[model samples]
Target: MEDLLGSYIIFLILLFVETKGIPPVTLAIIILNMFIFLSPALGVGEVCLSVSTTLYGCEWQRLALAPLHHIDLDHLGFNMASLVWKGSRLERRIGSARFTFSICSFGLLTGLTYLLIKATLSFLLSDRFNLDCAVGFSGILFALKVINNGHSCDGNIPGPFHIKKRDACWAELVLIHLLSPRSSFVGHLAGILVGLAYVMGPLRMMINWITGKETSSVRFAECCQLSRNGHPDRDSDGDCQSTCLPRHRRQRRRC
Candidate 1:
């Protein structure tokens, strides 16, 4: 438990440093590589599940908790490095707190979704197939990429970047096909849906509610108005003069 807490603290520290403009990818890759190398020397094999079972005396039932216990120092280092870079860039643009929250929330959501899908599949295939425990950071990475691709805008404007959404989605689809050919497409699809939901669902609502501003194409015009006039504040005539006067008041002013 102390080791687990320590590892998490290190991750947070790395994340903080990454947000401050330090590139942490190389460090992550190094850590993961070390784990890969040491696992064999430690007689635990390359499979993380074996190491966890040997070290902690846990069963396959605890696979879901493996990520918390088994620190694939190398794989996770590399994964966190990439995510930190990507997430930090996004964070810089969107503000650190919001970006951090988005990444953590999306990761948790993806992890839960992966677990549910794996559990259901395991139950369904109990008679025919024996599924081994699987653990990795791939799902979270995929989710982040999907959300970033889908929700990205061209300099805070909308429409022109809409085409990129389709392109990004297709790129991920192709990559999944090439990489995890035998993997269930449902999991990937779920990740994509979850990514989209993070953008268009809860994250969007939370940001809007907290910042009192819209962050979607559907509300682009409204956002423009708010930006121009300042939100939650009205002009003398009760018109949002930041962008334009209200329709009724325009007529009244003319009269």
Candidate 2:
């Protein structure tokens, strides 16, 4: 309960600094999660992520929904805090449409990764790992963290452990699992693996192909120009070239 309250405080602080209020993609996700958490009618537990249940019982919808479900208030709180940071930043850095597709794909892939690893371990170890379920948005957060840091310098992250900014999220995943026995160690590890796969794998290409969307490189460049020129207001028509300098001049300035 205390942790949940602290998360709310942190969330409010994040809202203050965020250039844009909650991006639509992130807002929709938060609302969905809140509804699931507050309404006993939702029954997230019945569909939570469990390897045995997923494979044997064939509850495939759990793969998509489990990441939205939290184990408890603290679990939900911590994940939401991370979500506000990573979601807002990444969604802004890339367009909101891309950000939504990326997270949805990551969540699905993360669940698949966990299921595969659990099945392998169960087959080889013969009763070592538990068939119990896992649930949280932490996996998607880790993937977003990887994507965010992959694109920019994340700066010196403050911590006693002193991990590099790019590597801090991975370190935090390990630390969180180690500190809390009840936390899903395998689930978090699966998230990291899935994150790596999403960044390095052809999943991105597949996304582009399916969505028929071009890379955000040009859009991002235009947005930077708009901000630099003190015209941060985005045109509702979606054309970023509004009130912007010519391409050659912008290139020359860069050179």
Candidate 3:
């Protein structure tokens, strides 16, 4: 997790450099140092400790204020750098601001959901077992994979041996079979659901709302008919009149 955080920090720095006049090559070097070298040196234990202390310890405020400064490089390691790199590339293609927001939101939501479920299970089975100390990028990674593969509805990539239609469904089934007995799978499932909801719900709404600024969902022919009858085409014209006005004006007298 610390490694992931380090990568995020490096990406942010690269963004800053791009905004300025700094060379992109320099940013690449920084990325290599932070992700490839520093991360493995730090390992997983330090990363978990950092998260626990920053989010729940007495010095939470200070740690939260400057988490990058406090990350322990000596206790972090990479698990699947290649997969993360691919996911990061996909995220860049999706647009950095949107990707960043979605990733962070999914991570937080998945973590909270896992914590709640574990807590509930522990209560229900009192003294039988204890659930504590969970950490991994599996959830966020799964979420990114889902988003990159074009959401749950799009299904999986079809190949000679791949399943068709409900591709995502099959991939998920395989994932469950592979990871079922592990605690991390719970978080992974939560993240997948969060990713699907985000893409199909809020993110879809936001993108449509933004792009539909000068148009309505109503068909153009319907708009013309309503407008010609002297009644406001409230569904379309009212919102899109400006977009259509120049063409309309060019065909008629201005008087």
Candidate 4:
């Protein structure tokens, strides 16, 4: 990951200097990436290649693990710096739990998208490099850029190049591929597509619906627990019909 992606790394490092409120889930992911990278037991062969049809068999679990492993300290640093930058914005805006769900879901989708892209390339054009393996958080970082930009498209993605928020992810993909000829081009492309898919609609709705349901379940469970203790959901207006969270502000601002 060099050139445009590398420039982003520098920009993100400078951008990440302000780490005021790095959320819990984001912190866990940064820690996990570091642990995975530093541990000799989890080397590249063990945690690499989310999917490579011509090489390793599809284990499925690797899809989640690959994003947590990086090739080197610089790679890890760039991604973690980015995680801190983007994760702070996203987790604060959407809350940690929902952010966690979004990461896992979009991460897997990005891996699968990589698989589909490789398969299509190999089948349609017989691209030999489709069998290669790639490992890093860059793919998911691209997706986070999508969500991040969608939430606040007030300006351009700052770096050496001036790119509007709406087109920044794609612009980075092409530029990185062009400038860093050895980079994981298809993998990066897959990430941008996954990001577009998310911002365009389906993924966002699914995450929101799932998290909302989980929150409601917890609220109900808390209400039941209180009832067992000779108390129940006591609303401000004396009507518990609104549930335990008072029906309005129990969740984060995203609520």
Candidate 5:
């Protein structure tokens, strides 16, 4: 860890590795993450450890920037590679619109989860985990993996261990924490919970109903027109055909 540049060499090599058929939103996230990593800010901001700065006030930006910032080049490279692999399956399965919504929603949701867990521990065990500042996309990556695993019928990660798909996220969570002892365990665990929330909890239904202005632009299986007055009108060839339906129901919008 002391040799940050040395750790970056492997990441540089991975830069040339080609991954085909990356979905558009996935690619955009990768580019945005990489750009932020290389920018003058280097993903540094009032985030990272801002969750529980003190009892009086919180930076709030941590909820937004933490997922996008990385501590090092190696971290950025590894996360981007994982996104390419995971996003290929997730974004393609659910359509870029829903996947995009999930990513944004999951990021904020996981941060709140992280804070709650930290606060709980701080109260009970005096762990003071909430004051801990952390950054990176790995937490959300874990969340995505949980959802991806849900879509698998056979539902097991194919490997020497034959880990059951249901438990794979927990296994990886432990493995990642062990390997990188410096990483925040609470942040990662929060992501796993968020994924579970999305899979079996109220998250999916909530996302389905909360109509953002961007909802009209999403690709549903069939385009439903929103009348100019802002209600769903009868199906017509009007350009207003738009937005998402429930999970596993919507197909890519042709219009």
Candidate 6:
């Protein structure tokens, strides 16, 4: 019990410090999730993502707020840790505007995915559908994890069984599901689908429109490289125009 308490204490301290230099949207998301989880007395749980309530009763707002609530300390801590690790890097790579847009799009879709599945199951199995009252930011974490792994070049992710970088997201999905019983499997699976949709489907086009940045192919590389050189701003044409660039070389070459 003492160890558990200590873990929570440490998590709180780390969360406080982790916001430093984090992309604005990412930091705000972490703060919002933490605040809502710690303030359950405010009746945040009623807005939790519920398939039955959302679909049958038409409480659509729950889909937006549900990911911000958590079942317990462990669930919250695990999801937050993953968010900090993957979200911070992805936000830096894609820029805050695109990152925020992606999070909103992905979060809603994940809830909708769960809703679709539950509705189908209900129809197929009448009285036997288990309406899992899912909550927490795991779905977004999973979505961000998929995006991060796709853009990362840090080689393989180290673990009990070493896995290649490209395959790490799937490995994590499987492993975390096996370890975290409280986590919603369908929600995380939906997050994966959303990530893939963004990468391969029309969602990518929407993100590009939202941020005015090309998110498809070369933009990830350009964003990471330019940010590394301390140039977060891009030109109207979506090319790096950092003040750090030489006057003659600003448009033609890297800083």
Top TM-score hit: 2
TM-score of each: 0.48, 0.77, 0.47, 0.72, 0.73, 0.74
Tens digit per residue, CA lDDT, model 5, 1-255 = 436644554553454255445678987998788778767364354557444652226667667888898887778878888888777667776678878888999999888888887777888887556567788998899898887666443234668998877689889888988998988888889999998887784786787776332242232213443346965433232222223233213533322
Ranking by lDDT: 2, 5, 6, 4, 1, 3
Cα TM-score of candidate 6: 0.74
Q: Candidate 4: TM-score?
A: 0.72
Kindly report which residue stretches of model 2 are placed more than 4 angstroms away from their true locations once superposed.
1-20, 42-44, 128-130, 154-156, 159-162, 217-255
Clashing pairs in 2: none
lDDT of 2 by residue, 143-208 (tens): 887766554422456667667656876787878877988887778878787767655747767877
Q: What is candidate 5's CA lDDT for residue 161?
A: 91
lDDT per residue for candidate 6 within 73-113, as digits (tens), equals 77877777777767877776667777787889889988898
Candidate 1: segments with Cα more than 4 A from true spot? 1-81, 123-132, 154-163, 180-190, 206-255
lDDT of each: 0.47, 0.70, 0.44, 0.68, 0.70, 0.69
- Model 3: per-residue Cα lDDT over 1-255, one tens digit each: 666776766755565554442233223423554554444544333433122343345333321122122223322223234234434444444444445454555656666665555556656876322324445555666666555444222222556566643246336646565864543455566667765664556744664465442221222222232246655433221222333444444543320
Clash pairs detected, candidate 1: 28-77, 28-78, 31-74, 32-73, 32-74, 32-75, 228-242, 229-242
After superposition on all C-alphas, the RMSD of every candidate to the true structure, in Å, is 11.2, 6.5, 12.0, 11.3, 10.2, 6.7
Q: Which wins on lDDT, candidate 2 or candidate 3?
A: 2
| TM-score winner between candidates 2 and 5 | 2
Question: After superposition, which runs of candidate 5 have C-alpha atoms over 4 Å from their true positions?
Answer: 1-19, 42-45, 54-56, 211-255
Worst 10 contiguous positions by lDDT, candidate 3: 62-71
